[model samples]
Target chain A: MANKVLVLGEVREGALRNVSFEAIAAAKQIADGEVVGVLLGDSVANLAGELIAYGADRVVTVEHPHLKSYTSDGYSQAFLAVCEQEKPEGIILGHTSLGKDLSPKLASRLNSGLISDVTEIEGAGEDAVFIRPIYSGKAFEKVKIKEGIVFATIRPNNIKPLEKNASLTGDVASISVDVQNLRTIIKDVVRKASTGVDLSEAKIVVAGGRGVKSAEGFEPLKELANLLGGAVGASRGACDADYCDYSLQIGQTGKVVTPDLYIAAGISGAIQHLAGMSNSKVIVAINKDPEANIFKVADYGIVGDLFEVVPMLIEEFKALKVNS
Target chain B: MNIFVLVKRTFDTEEKIVISNGKIQEDGAEFIINPYDEYAIEEAIQVRDAKGGKVTVLTIGGEDAEKQLRTALAMGADEAVLINTEDDLDELDQYSAAYILAEYLKDKEVDLILAGNVAIDGGTGQVGPRVADLLGINYVTTITDLEIDGTNVKIVRDIEGDSEIIETSLPLLVTAQQGLNEPRYPSLPGIMKAKKKPLAELELDDLDIDEDDVEVKIEIVDIYLPPQKAAGRVLEGELSQQVKELVNLLHSEAKVV
Candidate 1:
């Protein structure tokens, strides 16, 4: 075995996403030898040192001018060049929008197979088993790579990144590839800018459903979310009812979140909705219906009207903060 | 213009998965066109209507898939193709499925291809890009909006919740994300018209593709349901007291606050 593993560090808006470090942690778990990190973009040289602090044995960067924004065509060319240069036996990437789009093309170019969105890895080296959710977290499967390279895309917020050790350092190597023939162009961007927190990575989530009544009904939930420094989420019911944009939808067809604290107000736990959030660490369900399916999975259930209960909880939380 | 949409028949988004004897029990399961694929199909038909082209819905499955193909036709697709894989193969991972689809599409003058961002059953979101790579075409994924004029194309892709505007050209493959467009239901007249729509069925031999060349590369070791959550505790008594207790519990017991 070549025993070298390659991990792709994802950079969004000039900063390294937490999952990039997490991918390095996961790569170290599955690699028997050196865990090398790869960065692509116009100016990602500064991030190589960050990767080294989090356990990357060395860093390889491709700083092509065309690699400023993520184009599948551009990234595939840059990454494939790195693969040829390194010839790593294993590869790890975050299963974000970029990885989901890029890894498949790279796998096809490599004549390899991919295990996408893996949540856990067991054992080390080629014999490692990757566990991934299927059927929107209702079921899980254990998969193993059977041919070519050990390629996998890991979901964010699952693997813990190696602790930052400023004392640790590694070599940084910059490489170049001819990135041309780009068929896609980036014209503009529209950022949601609703909350600073990304929903999938939020530690606490304040979510609403049809019981929130209307778009204005989400105001309180948003207030509480702002107070708690969390993100706002909505069930498919809320989105379909036109109360909120589908971008806020959280369910089987929407974003899947595993926050530490999930306060679901008026959201009857539809199977699809549960599949997205049932993994939250501490679920608090406030619904008028005592038998709302959410209560089944929640750690604490308040059988009352959310409009009333949520306000009171907010006040009480605030009071607690004051008294402390 | 030539446009193709890759469709898959999957368990309904609301259907509860039942695993029996180490396998997903599919008997009596209500299957529908993958919800995301519906977004792709609707976009395909809309593109064809604007650009003057044929919209073909293609899938790889058994005869049972004809029902889905008919559904696509009823939704305004001009034609359908079912590459039946039941007899020649038993299982399909992303790699083999992409291989088979690319094999069938290799000879066609493919201008644009649309597929769901991710199939709910597998949720890998791999096949479309894989097919594009195998055929040497450009691709984009999770596109919420698309526009075409002559050979020039533009797209709005969803990133987390933000939107990125992109420009591209034809001979492209794009995977549809949500909010592309509101999918239209198959009308009664459309269903009637679909009965007469062309649906061609082929096999591995039909494409001169050796089944051995498309062997699955990954092995599924096991499948099981996630652990069941313990029944929750429903608070009783006064509203403020309940609020007080809940806040205290979240702070002291769960340590999440």
Candidate 2:
């Protein structure tokens, strides 16, 4: 029998998170039997077609008013009930904030082993081997679970998301959740209002370090990111000094990003920072220092002041836009 | 509130890494308590001092890691427990280590458990949650700030730049991040006092876990150095010319323009 892989679809503001698609894409490659996705929200059934488009064969929707806001107990209970019924061969989830909090509890309830932040997964013998970064992305360790069920939490951006196939068909199953187990309640949710692009999911990331010199220096990076329809990122140093928004910081202590293209502006690459985004497909470094460590790993290096280089690049791009 | 902080000894971040024959060479390197775990120890001390409770530090490593256990004691843990095993066995992943630690804590009085978000060396960020699962406790990761009130713990964590405040009952697990607290350096008297503090050493047999159940299922095939990075092209010209050249490179060559 082919192994069944169940993915816990994460939702934010009543919408599917990008990582959810990434997980489904991964499941499509690793699972041989079926792909079932469990989603929890007040009215998440509406997103069923979206999940199917992303590769889920069946979408399980657990709806409850209490779940309108993300309460750990409520979300976990809903998913747990589904697991009890499905008894999937393997379970997958995003290693995001919500998934991190809930996956352990679910695993504990099922008394199963969990491999979190897995970078890759492949079949091995009766079970699957999960690969994860060890020693701070310095090495990879392949872990195999010799137990009843295989459980994994995948890091965001580790897999390329699959494109939606127009003919994909999905069946939406609505289920009710037990609200009694929910102990905590969310009073309010405050979102960072300035930008729509999430740095972790952006394909093109423009990151600045302390080399930017000042907070105002990020204006051009932001403009360029806007022009490219991507997001801005920053090194830990720039975030510590308040030169850029803390949300943009990328490193071991901050968000880990693996975008298609990563541009490091005015940043001397530190090991901690490099660990987060070194997996990016293409890296571009712009630093005045000829010996900046970033250039050592960057695919393209421009040794010059970012203030002078960034504005001119922006102007040239704008001219290209006008011409074409 | 009773708190237990877990610490791991790993290669220091500043140490220059060299890959020899596809394995890390550590002939002359120094190891220390993972920087993130120090925050866990510090938070445990602060919470214990404020609420009048006991803090026990736990670890699973080789005999040499005893130095880190002593350092945790010097940093103010009331007691320390070392789950000693073969030095080569220390290569066990976080899931294996967490299983051993959780099995040990199963018999102890533990109301709250703390750990770094992830070890600096491993950077896996999975141990805390895996341990919490093993212990059957609620788990919170990447906590930036925490406040304890009676049996309830309120925490604020950044989720992709948006902060979310999560409230959970006591006896839960929390993994500390870098900004949670500044780990205090052991004072002279503290170091002197820590030398005399009791360090309890326990073996896997002491924890009474079945070694057969935790056998190595996954074996590493090899570890190799990533390919050498390609040298970058230095775009030459005045600032304007350089910008135009960059635009051309991006459009014609790099193709990300």
Candidate 3:
């Protein structure tokens, strides 16, 4: 029998993020018998019942007042202690900023190998192979880890989350964590404050570029995004020129996203920008320029000014929703 | 602040990669400084210019890596150091390589050490932080913005869809992300100066690093090209028909819609 696969559950404000369930779904395909999920945080222990519903045979809860707020040292030390006890074959972590900080430290301490930002996983018996992009998402590399223990940090929105089972059961084990010895402290955290939608996890995204003309030009695109219940993204050009916030920029030099539906509004997609979001399920490009490279990959392209087309799209979506 | 920027010579991403057996085949690909490291070198030069100090660009690669060293010099680094070892640097694991560099830097009065967040070639963002941990200096990765005021450094990191600001003391190790600064091209005079500037060559034995200090943990069993793309379907007929066909293909075949 092989070692059980473990997933590090990620949650914010009590609700589980999509990446947590996706990690479990991925673990199920790779592990033979049991898939264990580890939940860390205060008052986050109750989420374990939800974890079993997502397909975990066991849930390890690390409950500490210090764990309530994420400190790099606390999380790493706690996770390291968990690995010491469980001795699982592999651990899965989401490739968010937190995971990026925690994974390498954990891998270093365990003397284990980590495959970062993995897009796919395949397992045959005890051998689990991971596929990830290299050269800044220009190409993909499949790495086989045949060492002591394997660790992987998966990119969010890349994997599909499994449906909730609702009939599963699992034991919740709590591990104690010490609060002292955390070196780097986060002085301040500034959130965007808008609850419109999380672009990072959204299945659908409508992106604008410099071609949108001005900040006001984004209004129709925002309406379209709202109608679709998605988030609005932007190209580097749009962000650099102050057409939108830098948070929305998507490119090799910016945020990498892979959504189910990616609609480009007046965006002459540069290759660097495309490299980030090219893995999207369906790309619909709307630009007046017929020669835009975005049309090369777009499943449906509209060659017209976004000002004319986007408003019609919002109106059409509203009518369709009302009719349905 | 006296800064040192570490760079690696890697294959350009523009070239089509060909992998054979378990290694990346370099039959016809032209290698250059990993693109992200350029940002680190640029930031180092900027710091030196502002603070009135020298910036040294260091690398542990083959003789041909000198071009990238000269490029770094041309970009405004005052000096260059190359650990001219016979070992294939790509084959040499990062721990051993960083250990060698750390041993070398112990002698220099380095106030700051900068590196690319991750080498595009290896795609491992481990070296900077791992080296920091080994040296026991504070390490900050994925730094989008950096400010040096006296000795206190302000590092702005992009967290989960947000930014976290952290303040730490100097003599720190930072891994710079893209957009930290725009890299400068070598001026004609800068290129001429690079030619005259001395780039010292050293051996693995020259450095005081102990061989046993570097513990190699990870072994890459194999590396291969990703699967080939299937031929894409072109929806033909009228605009509405094409849209309908594309929608069907997306919802049913892709299954992600």
Candidate 4:
């Protein structure tokens, strides 16, 4: 009999995060038997059909009130139960904030090996090898499970999601686990996140730096990001300069992103800032300083004041969108 | 109130990675306390100061790691511990690292534990949460702010770009985020004091564990740097012409538009 693979379909704001489908897609590439999708939330049974259509052979939902907001205690209890019951040969989850926090605990509890932030997978079934970024994407390491179950976390936007096949559907089963003694309780969630696309998952990002002189300086970057339907980010210099909140910071000690198009405006790229975004697919730099390090990593560079270049580029992008 | 901070010595982020023989060459690499752990140590010190307790800095490495531990002590940690795994294990993974740390901690009187959100070298933010799971305690990762009153604690953790306020209690573990606190440098007086501070070193044999107990589960098949994106074209012209050229290039060559 072939081994069964379990895919954790992570839900956020009532919908399954895109990385969930990407994980299911990854599980399909590795599964020799049935690929099971597991959903955990207070009300997530309704989201199971999409997982099935995306490639899950079956869906399991663990519903409990305490599971609504993510607490390691509650989620681990619920997921561990499904793992024991199903005895899955493999487990896959998204390497998001939730996955990063949850997977290690689950992997530890199961006494299983975990390959995290995997950007690529090779081979199939037990022979599969996982490729993950080490040293903050400075280097790549190809790892494999020497023994025991295959457990891994895929970085968001790195892997491709399987296309939906509406003709494909499966049964969605519900299970209950006793969730108590949670040492941590969420009091509230304060959202300072920009209403724009999630930066990590965004296809394009317009990032600013110290040259963005003031808090109001980010407004133009935000406008450019909005025009491109992308997200706005900042270098630590900009964040440190108080031009923007630390939430928008990207660099060595900040969020690492691999957006399709990273437009760096007025940012003299430091190695620290480059550490977070050097992996971006197509980097474009608009800086007045021709000698800026950002130009070295960029696919294209424009030497000019960002105040003038950004607006002109935004207009040009607008025209291109119209023509398309 | 007894606080513990987990520290690891890692390559400085500024250093260019030099890999040879499929392994990161560390012969002369400058190492420092993992930057995020500095935040953890700072937080531990502040928590200890306010709540009337001592902070113990703990790390799992060889004798060389004692320098980082002493640095933590100089930053105000009450004591330091170095679990010398050099002779016992050739390589350490997150699983074994967590297992050994948990085993050592399982017997201690721990009121609070802290660690960096992620190590700069490994870049895996797993040890703190895994240790917490092994010890069967609650944990919050990437915490930006923490408040404690009696046995109750409130934390603000960074979830991507947003914040989640959580209520928890001791004994709890939290992984420090970047903005958690400003880590203090070791003062000359503090450095002198750290010389007298206790730094307890132990080995796997002392912990009653062997090679098979906490074996590494994941095997690294290969290690190499990603192909660096070569420097591309730098457009030159009037502002408007440059904008037009960039748009054309993004569309025709890049196709990312």
| Highest-scoring model, lDDT | 1
Q: Candidate 1, residues B95-185: lDDT per residue as tens digits? A: 9999999999998999999999998888899999999999999998999999999988999999888899999998999999888999999
lDDT of model number 2: 0.78
lDDT of model 1 at residue B109?
93
Q: Write the per-residue lDDT of candidate 3 for residues A54-142, one digit (tens) a residue.
A: 89889998887767666566787788778877888878888876677777777766766667888887664466677787655666767
Cα lDDT, model 1, residue A271? 88
lDDT of 2 at A57: 94
Ordered list by TM-score, greatest first: 4, 1, 2, 3
Q: Please state how well chain A of candidate 2 matches the true chain A, as a TM-score.
A: 0.92
lDDT-wise, the better of 2 and 4 is 4
Candidate number with greatest DockQ:
4
lDDT of 4 by residue, A131-160 (tens): 888878888899988788889999999889
Off by over 4 Å in 3: A193-196, A240-242, B10-32, B84-110, B208-257
Q: Write the per-residue lDDT of candidate 1 for residues A205-226, one digit (tens) a residue.
A: 9999999999999989988888
Each model's lDDT comes to 0.91, 0.78, 0.76, 0.90
What i-RMS does every model get?
A: 1.3, 2.8, 3.5, 1.0
Which of candidates 1 and 2 is the stronger one according to DockQ? Answer: 1
Candidate 1 chain A: worst 10 consecutive residues by lDDT? A192-201
Candidate 2 regions exceeding 4 Å error are A121-130, A242-247, B16-24, B87-91, B216-222
Task: Give per-residue lDDT, candidate 3, residue B97.
Answer: 68
TM-score of chain B of each: 0.98, 0.92, 0.92, 0.98
